[model samples]
Target: MNSTKCQKCGLTNFATDLECKRCGTSFVQKTRNSGSRPKFSIIAVVMFAGVAAAFYYVFTGVQGSVDKVNSVEANRVNAQPVLPPDAGRSRADYDRYRSQTVANAVGVSPGLAEHANRTQQTDKAMDQMTNSRAQ
Candidate 1:
């Protein structure tokens, strides 16, 4: 290899030298593109490792949970709520009967009907304003 002078001490050494080889001064700071990564690069490596570990744990945990649910289903016919065998009919049935009783005879409040009419008029006015502006 060819020789070059050190910028700090002016000492001459081979071109492939890392240090001055005389004053012990470093030739230049190592960069990422230069062969191996430096020891101080732990931050980036640790962050990458942490993200990968977290993703791995999440994926494996989700897979385990899914497998557990599938196994439970495979071992049983179906799951049912913990209720008495002769449980009474649900409240929905009573509500259904009430709704049917009031279906045709249901009445709307006069105030609500007036509010709806006002809303329709306001919408029509706004539409007219927008059309006028566009022209």
Candidate 2:
């Protein structure tokens, strides 16, 4: 006949018995098999690492392309037109030409907004010159 050992009182009991007779402890046999636990595999780890690296590579490539396009647009918008050299011009004529150049450049290049302020100063100076000559 098969017998089960009581863990609490160390009493041997028949397998059919529900509880130990001496201490009233239940007799349940513990299995020593380790098959229920999960085992580690290197292939799973390597595959996960490869998928992470692929996502990083794709994200970086897209970000780099966007940055490159933004830089190109910035360079194009910031570019200023080159003007020809002025030769043999009176002070009033040169000031008038410069004012006209700045006025024409007002919405063409966003970077020239600061230089547009000089057109107002040029007009003020021209008015002063004309008023002084009239007086």
TM-score list, all predictions: 0.31, 0.34
What would the per-residue lDDT of candidate 1 be over residues 1-135, giving only the tens digit for each residue? 487677678889887887778887675553223456555677898999999999999999999999999989966745645656535757897788688766534345666567778999999999999999999
| lDDT comparing candidate 1 with the true structure | 0.76
Q: In model 1, where do residues sit more than 4 Å from their true spots?
A: 1-40, 78-135
Which candidate wins on lDDT? 2
Question: Which regions in candidate 2 have their CA more than 4 angstroms from the true location?
Answer: 1-36, 80-135
lDDT for model 2 comes to 0.81
**For model 2, how does the per-residue alpha-carbon lDDT over 60-91 read when each residue is reduced to its tens digit?**
99999999999999998789676786778889
In candidate 1, how many clashes are counted? Answer: 0
Among all candidates shown, the one with the greatest TM-score: 2
- The predictions' CA RMSDs to the true structure, in order, are 12.6, 13.6
